[model samples]
Every structure is written in C-alpha cells, then in structure tokens.
Target: MRGKKGNKEVLKRILLCIRPYTSLVVLSLGLAVITVGLTLYVPILTGNAVDYIAGKGSVDFGMLGKLIVLIIAAITVTAAAQWLMNHVNNMITYRIVQDLRVQAFHHLHRVPAAYVDSHPAGDLISRIITDVEQFSDGLLMGFTQLFTGVLTIAGTIVFMLTIHPLITLVVVVLSPLSFGIAGFISKNTFQMFKKQSETRGELTSLTDEMLGNLKVVEAFGYQEKAQERFEEINERLAGYSLRATFFSSLTNPATRIMYSIIYAGVTLAGCFTVIAGGLTVGRLTSFLSYTNQYTKPFNEITGVITEFQNSLASAARVFRFLDEEPETEDSPDAEELTEIQGKVELEDVAFSYRPDQRFMEHLNLSAQPGQRIAIVGPTGCGKTTLINLLMRFYDVTDGNIYVDGHEIRDITRKSLRSNFGMVLQETWLKNTTIRENIAYGKPDAADEEIIRAAKEAHAHNFIMKLPQQYDTVLGEDGGSLSQGQKQLLCIARVMLDLPPMLILDEATSSIDTMTEIRIQNAFGKMMNGRTSFIVAHRLSTIREADVILVMKDGKIIEKGTHKELLKQNGFYAELYQSQFAPS
Candidate 1:
C-alpha cells in the first residue's frame, strides 16, 4: 500500500496549485450539484404523476401534460448545468497544467550543478512534461465526474430512505463490497503504476543518451550493445505497464457485478412489500429508481478511484523533483563585481567531487594581471575542476579563491561570471540564425560589432559562404555547421563580450591544422591584455605562455616560463617532447 502521509502531501500540493482558481472550482462543483439535484427530483415528480393518473379510474390528460412539461424543464436544466460544469473543469485543468509546467521549468534553473550531474536530463523532462500532464488529466476528468457522482449517490440514497427505509439499509450494507474491491485492487496497482512511471523515465533517458552519442557509438562499433541496452529498458517498462493496467482493469467489472446482485435483491424485496400493501406501487417504483441512481455511482466512483491512484503515483514523481534542494543562495551582504582586475589567486584551496576523496588539497596559485597561464596535466588531475572553483560553479571546499582581493564567494555569481569568458572543448550552439548564435553573449550587440567579432575569430569567411550569410538558421545544436565552424561561433561570442578574463579548454581542438593556426593568431590578439587560463591536450598550443604549470595528480609539479621549464627539464619538458617527437 502507498504511504498515507505521502499521498496526503501530494494531494495537498495539488490542491494548493489549484487554489488560485477558487472561484472556478466553486462554480464548477456548484453546477454539478445542481445538475445531480435536478436529476434526482425528476424521479419523484414522475412517481407523483403515476399516482395521480392511476387514481379513481379516470385518466387526467391535463395533469399528465403538466408533469411532462416539468420533466422536460428539469431535463433542460440538468443538461445546461452539466455543460457548464464540463467547460469549467476543462478550463481549470489546462490552467493548472500551465502553472505546474512553468513552476517546474523555473525550478530547474535554481537547482545546483550536483543534482543536475546526478540526474539525467530526459528523466527531468519526463517529470515536467509527461508526468505532469498525466496527473492533470486524471485530476480534471475524475473531479468533473466525482462531484456529480457523489452528490447523486447521497441525494438518491436519502430519497430512497424516505420512500422505504428497509430497502435503503440493504444498499448501505452492500455499498462496502464495491468500495472494498476498489480499495484492494487500488492497493495492488499503485506500486505497479509507480514502477511503470519510473521505467518510462529510464527509457527516455536511455534514448536521449543513445541519440546524443550516436556518432561515438557508430565510430566505436557499439551499436549492438546500445540496442541491447535499449531493449532491456523497454522490456522492463512494458512489463510494469501491463501488470498495472491489468489490475486496475479489474475494478470496474468486479464492482458492477456485486452491485447487480444488490439490485436484484432490492427489486425482489420491493415487490413483496407492494403485494403486502406495506408500500404504494408508486412509492416502490420511485424507490427502485433511486436505488439504480444510488448504486450506479458506486461503479463510477470505483473507476474514479483507479484514475486517482494513477494520478497520485505520477504526482509523487513530479513533486519529488520540485522538492530538490536548490543551489545555496548568495550571502545577504554579497557584493557585486563592478570593475574586475585581471589578477586571480587561489589560496589554500581544497576540493573533491565526493567527501571521501580529496582531489586537491592545500593548493595555492596566483596570476598577475594580463598574464598568460597555461595548465598542463594528465587527464583527471583536477585541471577543469580548478576552473570550476574559480568561476564559482562549484565552491572551494576548504579555502579561498580571490579576484581583485575579494573572495569569489563574496560576490554575486552573475557579476563574478560576467567578467570571465569561456570556450570549452565541447561547443554549444543553439538552433537559431548564425548571427544570433554569435551574439548570444550580448543579445543587443550591433550587427557591425558581431561581424567584427566573427572576423576576429576567423569565422567570417565561411559564414559568408552560407546560403543566407549570417541570417542562415542552423539546425538543433547547430548540426548543420561543421564542428570547427560551431567552435568559431562560440569563440566569436566570447570575443564580442570581451570579458577581462578568458578560459580556453582545447578551444581549437576540432579545427584543421591550418584553421587552428589562423584561429590561434586571432586568439593571440584577443588575449593581449586579458588574464588567460589555457588547458590544451596539444602541448604546442601553449608554447608561448608567460607561465606553464605542470600538474600531476592535482599537485603542481613544475611552474615557470617555457624556456625556464625546458631548461629545468622537468615534467613539462617530457610532456612537450612526447607530443612533438611522436613516432
């Protein structure tokens, strides 16, 4: 069985989300009550008409006409009320969906990088899109019928009790049988539905990961392995879905079958009462009408219970995502970085991706304004991790990183990051016009400035060759452009912004050798007076750095200018020779 407290929490949150539309909810439920009330009253009027027409052996055509008119009026009122209720229900459903989607989307931005790194993007997307929609649909459809079903049941039972209390007691006792069956089936189905939802998210994540790395999988001849992984996840999803649906499907038929028996018993008992003159024929007929009305809602409610259970499962998933702790907020007295100098220093820095493993400890470094700092290290030696700390993407665990004499964490993240420009090995370009992609860092940049930035990044010649020049709309992630071209656009973005500090991580790795040379010349001009940190796999790229820091296992093993490092003949010299003197 599901946790009662957790379900209540989910329900409470859902209600809060809908609380803004209180007037709509009241109007919708009111219309449903009115519709059900008119329906129940119709049977009472029909019973009275029957008694009047059967009295004293004379047919009263006038009374019959009047009864017919009243019944028609009730029918019209019921229809109008139902239509209005349905309209309101639909409106509330879509509006709540919109609000929930917006809230989830906004929450994602506030979430920390650690949470994002741990969770798959597709799983997050599933919660926001598919799960929210399922929960919303179930809430709207079930609630629309639920109000009418409940009021109809209560009103019909009360009317039947007034007509014949003895038979109404029978309904009260048998009603539990339907509810019991629904409860039992729902308990079994809840976990199955929950599992199915989880598996669906896994499947979505798998598909996204596979498609995003299709080229790598093909190049490494891992297509069969990828397909096998997909099939495994897909099969698990199918199994859970089948079991959940099978159990929930049992509720309606089982409840209806039990209610059929109750209906038969009520009919037989009423006939005997009428024969013994204990109840009028008209009263028995009215009671029978009310009995059908009362018991039919049990089946409706059983179906609604299944819908609600499924919705609750999906809602639990969505709410769990929204409840994640976001990134730590800036300090109350945080200062904004108004004018940054190029000097940066890391004092007694310590960091680790996990608590048990300290990747870097007691690290200290400093860069003078307008210095070219090149960091060379073996893979997994905390090179990028250092940059992450400086930019405040991840905070230093045990020490301080300062920019212009102020600790990095004391500054607002937006302002601190605004002073640094980054071009990583993996280029990120949006699906938009070429000009827009280049001008992303400065959305309001002038056309001439954008072109000049592109020219400086050595991208203008090829961009001009495109069908629409800068106006060409690129496909998703700029798939229409080559890797080198995409990198150029990314570089142009930073060049246009002209941040005081630059971080280049294999910025020219994807370009051909000739293009690399051209772009490096452009980068040399761009880096003239900026504090730059260059991380490159190709040792030749940083040959002219003001200082080269050779790292091994997160510790600095050597640091000096190129000539000084070479004369020392240390780790940096070995790394440089290994690249230049290849077999």
Candidate 2:
C-alpha cells in the first residue's frame, strides 16, 4: 500500500515524528503481541476440548476447569492489552497533533509575505485543521493497526503451520488473491482521496472569499452570483467525496468476500482430509479456527491500509505548504540601527507588481529629519506604493532606498521597521476591548498612558460612553465600531508606539469633516518633531505641509510648498484647485 518510494524511508520519517515517544510505541506493540498470543491460544484450547470429548474416558473435570480459567485469563489479559494499546495510541496521536499544529502555525509565520498574500486563508486553515487531523487519524489507528495486524497474521500462520502444515499451505495459497483485490482497491482509493483533498481546498477557498467580501456582494447585489459560485464548488466537492467513499467502502466488502470464499474452500478440503483418514476432528476444527483467525487480521490490515492512504493524501497537502520558501531575512552580518534621526531618501526607485508594468521608476525624493512631507496624487498614481516601499513590503527592482543615511537593505528589517509607526487607510482592530486595542502597539503601556493616547486620537469620549468603557469587547475586526471610531483607534495605537517616523496613509479619509479637523489637530501635535510622510488624495489635508510631492505614474512630477506649487500651475495646482476650490 505504500508508495513506490522506499517504504524504509517513509517509515523512517514517520518514526522520526514519533521518536520522542519510543517507549510508548514499544509498550503498545508488546500489548498487541500479548493480545494476539492470547487470542491464538483460544482455538488451540477448543481443539483440546474436542479431543478429550472424543476419547472414551472420564470427564477430566480438573483439566476442563483449568482450560476455563485459562480462557477467562486470556480474555481479561486481551482486554487489558487492548485498553493499553488504545491509550498509548490516543496519547501518541494527541501529542503528534499538537506538534503538527505548532509546526504548521510556525511555518505559516515563516512563509514569505508574498506567498501568504496570495494564499487563501480558508484553504490554509483547512490544511492546518482538516488535513492535519486526517494525518493524526492515520498515525493513531492506521500505524498501530498496521503493525499489530502484520504481527498477528504472521504469528497466527506460523502456529497454524506448526500444528498442521498441509492446511496452512492451502490457506496461504488463497491469501494472494485476497491481497491482490485489496491492493487494487487501495491504490485506486488513494488516488480518489487525493482528488478529494484538492476539491475540499477549492471549496474552502471559495467560501472564504465570499465570506470575506460579503459586504461587496450585498452592495453590488451579487448575492445570487456568490451563491451560484459557492454551489458549484460544493457540488464538485461532493462528487469527489462520493468517489473516494465508493472506493474506500469497496475494500472491506471485497476483502470479506475473498476471505469467505477461501474459508469455504479450506473447510471442504479439511473435511475431505478427515474423511480420507489423514486428519482428526480436533485438528480439523483447530485448523479451521486458525484460518479464520488469520483472516481477521488480514481484514483489519486492509481497513488500516485504506485509512493510511487517505491520510497520506492529506499529509501531502500539509507538507506541500510547509515546504514553501519562507520570507527572506537579513544576513547575520546585517547592520543594526540603534538610533534613527528619520532622514529618508529614495534614489531612482523603480517598482512593479508585474514586470511589464512599472509603477515607479527613477523616483527620487528626500526628507529631512522632523520635516513634514505630504504626497498628493490622483487615484492609482503610486501614492500607496511609496509608503509600501518605505515599509519594505516589497523590494525595489531598481535603485535603492536610504534611511538616516544608511542603505535600507543593509539594515536589519526589524530595526528598520521599529523606527516608524504607521496608520493606514483601512483600519484593522482585533476582537478586543478599546483599551487593549489602543495598547496593542505598545503592550507595556499603562492604563493612563492608553487613555491619554485615545484622547489624543479623539477616541476616548466614545470609548468611555460604552457600558464597559475601555473593557467592552469588540466584534470580529471591530465590526461593532464605526469607520471613524476604528480609524481613531488605529491612530491611537500608532500614537502609543511613538516611533521617530510616522507614515499616515489616508489616515483621515474615513472621518467626517468635524472629526477630521479634530483628528488633524491631534495628528499635527503627534507629528511635531517627528519625521512624517502623509499620503492623501484630499488636497485640503496637505495645505500646511512643509513640502508637497505630486506623483504621477510613480514619478514625482511636481515638488514645492503649497503657495509655490499653486503658482507653478502644474499637476499639484490642478489637483488642489479641483478638490478644494469653490464649485
């Protein structure tokens, strides 16, 4: 049932996963062996009873009583062994699952930002939860039963042969056919399971996409369209599931039929041998019992194999995700920036989401320490790209960016990012209290400090009005809060961090004019003596900027103060007049 790749290597990898619990594995195996031995003794005892009864002798009550005690002992021992095996198997599975979950989560953290951005959240979650769970099932039941079944089958056959070799020979002859059928079914079942896993991933991805964009679907009146897409994925998943189940279900019945035919044939042959004066009734009875014993393990082995194949399919998906390259990190020799004055420069920076379409090229800009630089541009004019580059969300395809006179790539990413605080266009808040959200950027901030930051961002009044005040729990993504409230909370989070450089990317876009004025005043105070970059489409917001850069096609076409840019009558002047001038 194992793949073409060496079973030794595959087993080695599996063993490595369980190496820490070697003692438990050994104990479970010992229990299984004991249980098998006890089970095998039952039929032999039954044969002995038949021989005693056939003899024209006394009842031999003492011997019968002893056999009875042995039977009870065997049952008790087998039950205890089964319990131990089950316990050990469960413990190992739980530990392996825990380890796997941790590894999956850690791998997710290590994966490249670009990879994560492209991967669907629901599919990834399915791999971690569903796929990993499937693997655990195989590890527990599949692995344990496989090992125990092999030993039981082998031991049962060896003892049966020792007692009656001819009967054992006949039974062994029929076994290959049974194995052939099971093997054929198992191979096909594994293929179906792989397809099933892929379909499930697609289904999860589609559902996640729809749920995440629920607002867009309703606003665009595309509810029926979304439902249709979801239904299509669901139907495909159902089809794959049915195919997998069909193949898997066939294995058991097929094995059972093959074993039943072999049993009938063996019984007829044993009866003929007895009639020919070659075997006694006791021997015939015991041989038939041993034949049945062998089939039980064979049946179990087939079931385990099917389960194992299914788990392998899930394991492949999970392993594929783990194998993906993680985010690149700076070299160990990378320079660390302890103190940053926040002087920033972009020299001939060129970037593109795709190679054919360059967003920014030869984009040169510089900002002095404590300077307030505002970037204004029409929609889709690379305003956000500038902030993204500054944050190193992506690397420049050409030229370099410098901070505090040091090349950015040369500096450690963590240290580079630590020097700046950001408030973005779309605010993201966790499902936590307002106070906790404000304190997130600086986890060690005192309650008073958190309250002060919230007040500065104009979030404190609304927060205090809630019944639980700062302790009230927010819903998922802070759905309970208004857009302005969420943005203010984000700003408050940024303020609490108090980094040397601040980048506000449309920070006031969601708030009303009155709230915007209040937030603007607060932002100006927060920006004092800190190097600041503002990316705004609203011309009125940058009226007081120390310098303005009007970006078009990722290049700065106009650079000047508000009065100078207005006088120049260039792109900046046109945008300003269009947005703020009287209608």
Off by over 4 Å in 1: 52-56, 278-282
Over the stretch 213-260, how does candidate 2's per-residue lDDT look in tens digits? 888889999999888988988888888788878888988888899889
- Candidates in order have lDDT scores of 0.89, 0.85
Candidate 2: regions farther than 4 A off: 1-16, 276-280, 355-357
Best by lDDT: 1
Please provide, for model 1 over 57-123, each residue's C-alpha lDDT reduced to its tens digit, 9 standing for 90 to 100.
7878888889989999999999999998999999998998898889899999889887898999889
| lDDT of the structure predicted as candidate 1 | 0.89
RMSD of each: 1.9, 2.5
Error of 2 at 430 (Å): 1.9
Error of 2 at 139 (Å): 2.6
